[model samples]
Target chain A: MEIPVPRPSEPAKVFHHSCFAMNTRFSLVLVGLEAEQARALAQTAERHLLACERLMSRFDAVSPVSDLNRRAADEKVTPPDALWEILTLCQGYWRQTRGAFDITLWPLTRCWREHLQRAEEPTDETIQRTLLQTGFHRLYLDEAARTVRFQSKGMSIDLGGFGKGYALESVAVQLRAAGVERAFLSFGESSITVLGSHPHGPAWPVGVGNLFSPQDAVHTFQLRDASLSTSGTAPFNAAGGPRAFGQIIDPRSGRPIEGYRTMSVASPGGMEAEVLSTALLITPAEQRAELLSDFSAVSGVEIVYDSNAGEFVPRIEWKYGS
Target chain B: MDLDSPSLSSSGLESRADRREFLKRLAVLAGSSALIAELPWWSPLRVAPVAEAAADRVRLGLVGVGTRGNLHISHLLNTPGVEIAALCDDYDPHLQAGLARVKGAKGFSDFRRMLEMPDLDGVLIATPLHQHARMCLDAFSADKHVFCEKSLAYTIEECQAIADAHRGSKRVFQIGHQRMFSPAFLQALELVRNGAIGQITQIRAYWHRNGNWRNPVPDPSLERRLNWRLYREYSCGLMTELASHHMQVANWFLGAHPVACTGYGSINYWKDGREVYDNVNLIYRYANGTHAIYDSLISNKFYGMEVQVMGPKGTIEAEAGRLYAETPPPAPGIVQLINSLEHGFFDTVPIGGPSWVPDLKRDAKGTAITHEKSTDDGTAISLAAFANAIRLGVPIEGMMEQACRSGVSVLMGQAAMEQQREIAWPEGFRI
Candidate 1:
């Protein structure tokens, strides 16, 4: 979103403006309140103060080269403090999830991307090579110096799963600090974070759009001061595009997440919701409920599975309170 | 004019009449000055008395002990001047436990039956959310004081009825949203109201929890019917159970009722045939053109439990127990001008008939106060205040109607969530 260019002499009230961009496939909103509320939220996103959004900018720098790209020959290997903090957070999550949400699978992702670009499937040998290069335990993080290194040079890290949610969290915190008591940071159709509240309505009226029909919202969610993220194969696979080929890779078998079209989680923080959304989808149908209860951030969850009946069936939806 | 009578001889009659008049006038003057001398210069009307009664000796009774009701009894037993007089629960085990705590106190299943017992003076209601109305009505009918749990009642009609009952009885009635009595909350409220920070434009509140509903069934025959809170038949969900306290706080600070509301909820967890929401988020629009947002979930515990009040002058974070204000000291130029005057530089200047200058007031201090103890002391304080009001016959505002008004906003939030439309405040709504 373009930053609001304020004319100095204008009698400024709050200017509620939203910007749309394709990188994250969502919108950045600046709600110019009577004072500095919107500006504060914007700063939080820009500064990467939030764990979710902070990953996108710096993870790319630290990730191992998927292919030997000459452009990264003299690239700085060490990430900044902010990036290091995020990596540290991810490392802790890796231990917590036991590699369910591993970030060190960029090499496999790249290989799949190459195959998709060529409109062909990867050969067994190529798949085997990519699998060998990806393993959560293979990424070595140096705590003392705050650096990340791969056990094998081919190992890489990509933070695509959790980045947008973290960014929304950062913006929400900024909004709280800036005195904009409530707002919603909507990241395309994938996620939303309620900073404070709505101006004259309920928490926030969220439209849960139909997977088959993206234009129609089949259900609605009332949300406030919480982060809600949805992970689904439908967004990618709708047009059968290259990005859809094998995006949701299963850490267990190193293949696409099968039989799940959409999975959504409500959490107190964006990054927590993002990771859990992905993890819940890839979990076997039976163990999904038990696995979701492990995180305190998860308040409610809705998991949809692609049933053999040619329709997505709601496999599990659990809320915290009765 | 009666000169003919011997007693009315002009000079003698005049002297007699004057003598009588003098005595009567003397009495009148004496009475007037005496009345004037008896009046006090200032009465110093007492709002609350510190030394009126001992806290340990007051007898308390449980009128409708339920979930939060039991919690009240547990806390009250620990407080001074509070002793459980009788146990009044519709169910057996709850009543038994309460009676056990206050051995020998009377036990009655019906609240009115308990009220009729000569020993009871005050009643605490912790019944189903809907029962708050009828029980409070009975408590006030018996001329006993009341302390009803939060979200006071289930509907606006019930809220209004309770308010009328409280008003008609002229008895002390305190709602269970006890945070009102918490020192931190009180401090935060005062700071916001006093504009310590500035004009509060918005407020955010949340209470998130992760769990399933598995209360010990009161009766096997009742089954799901026994746990009324889990169903719409008895309770208001997260809004009533959790958001009520926070919403009341916000409403109190805003000094108004919500103008409108919009929200949504769903039954995603523990769908063991429960009607009340498992998750809810509500936003309220106040008459002052401000807003309050409340959210809660039953499945996750990553709780952001706080009330953030944002204002133009400063921000008061209730959870943090901190008040930040924009008290920039007088600018240096202003300071220098005052300094010059303090040194008698302004003595030669003509100014409003006298050379007057002000000091910097440099000792102004700002520090964040973290509450050392749990602010749950509100329950005790509220009880004490209610007792004091009953004993002293003092007027207490924000009775059941205030609770009802606050509750209506919660219901409105629910309505918004269900209907996906704005719920406007009814015209001439007192609460």
Candidate 2:
């Protein structure tokens, strides 16, 4: 019989703060501070996070990303300086991942999702048409004009999970510069970043646990000043075998990667972890190693859900060393 | 820590064995945008409790030293800027027991003498329901601030008298409806007020338990004192002891007292010659024609306890700290129509690839109003608020009215059940 799982002992004086931002809840854990001071620092971090969310949230009508998606098709839109840097960084990631990490595939994603919701496949004609509107190469960023323009009409860019990682990295930087030595921030339990080490250990032993049994650690990451992001497809039929409801669309195939699987990646930066987790999931098996080799101190794991077990059982299909 | 669960991801934040904080986080994350006003008394929660000097501490005297009183003592002992200066109980053993917990606290067999101590900043009355009114009036007459426990008083008149005494006083007069300070309740309140559940058309609340509500009495002579909750003279059975908490939440959300109430009661179980009924069911009608239905029994624990606020848009289980929408937001009228037909998500697409169709997932468990998963409830935070209010010398707004509305409402319930007729809310009450 399985014994009740125990949450590992926590260190003293860890103050927590939480707020709703980015259409999601953001939680912060700060250790070894007076409660009042921790609250102040967390509030500051929250402000920084909200600011980043305003810059990137595609759902926010007033957000710069939304403005870009609205006008960049016909006329050039000069993004804010900070956003321009983010766009350039995304372009870098797009090149590094060889288009696997493109953010311009939201139209294709919407198309696939609409068809999949009805348990039907979109026609090849429709996929080909959506393919025209996607691809990061089609979105031009002119360095001299500092303006962004889209090559096709009805094309849109969505930061999606990337926005959460960006917000986390931004807040983490603010905290580290503010002399915060130990902290934990999580957005929607998927994107996580930590500062310094755990109060009781040399590094924070953050574990990826079962969704139903949250304390049962399936895998543990002894992270020191690192971030982890998990990108996955939900099982289309949880009780049935091998069916997947696509979450992250593969920009190359113009369709989502087939199967119920997740890719978890850890890196020194939250944005890198976020980008690589999705990129690695879509990249072919042989190309994954070369894709990850470009980054320092990065590790990746693929957990493929075997639904034949009656209950969806996750098995590690692939692993890459940090 | 586990990165698997949203609730446990940062459970370390509330460092104490505080499931309350955990529940609050759950509610917030589950999308209960807690819209509680940033009241001043909660400053103690945000600010350091021990940082204030001893002179700035609010010295308090506790009158009752029984079950609830000892719970308060445990919280007050840990609360910052508060000192338990005196302990009082007519029962010498209870008084001694309380005194042992707080070193240097003066113990008195008579509560009146403890009220005379000029050093005490406030008095917390956690005595029997019958005694709340007298102690509150005396404490007020003595010019000490008062924090009285729930089910305010023995009768409607006494409830009025206590509120009247605290009316113009500069001192803080807080009624112990701790849900007022509960993070889960606060989150639930925000959802209700924001029209997340739309206009509340009805409310149904229930508290069910299988065991006989009794404390083991040391002797036959002490039965009334130790197990007073089961009696009519000293209490109104489950109504005042347990039902009042839910009543307070309902009244606060409804924003009005029940104009009339009717109920039925009977001593159907645990017939130990107890005067009060073992089971009771009541309906309170507010002026707006909406009704709050409540029921409790000491025979079935199946339903447990819950306060469900329902409207056309959704339903809120306040005690459970969850909100369920009739249709998940962004679901258009046609989607709702499809939902009513009970078609699965994978049903054939009836419309063309349209732009406005929502991506809907059929869900039933409802979103948790975070922090509701806490065993801490709001007792400790309410104690901190009490001490903070004493230090600031400001009364809690609507506290007396909350006390009277729920307090009198229950009394009305008791009367309706006992008298076998509808009982209207007391006319010309001064709360």
Candidate that would win on lDDT: 2
lDDT score of residue A319 within candidate 2: 88
lDDT of 1 by residue, A154-231 (tens): 665666656666566666766677566655455554777775543334444454444554433434455667777776
Q: Is the docking of candidate 1 incorrect, acceptable, medium or high quality?
A: incorrect
The sequence of per-residue lDDT tens digits that candidate 2 reaches over residues B40-144 is 334434433434488888899998888778877777766667789999999888898889999999998888999888788999988888999999999988999
What local distance difference test score does each model get?
A: 0.59, 0.76
DockQ of each: 0.01, 0.01
Off by over 4 Å in 2: A1-233, A236-322, B1-52, B330-365, B371-374
Candidate that would win on TM-score: 2
List TM-scores of chain B, every candidate: 0.75, 0.84
lDDT of 1 by residue, B162-204 (tens): 7666665666677776666555765576566566767888898
Which 10 consecutive positions of candidate 1 chain A have the poorest summed lDDT? A63-72
Candidate 2 chain B minimal-lDDT segment of 10 residues: B346-355
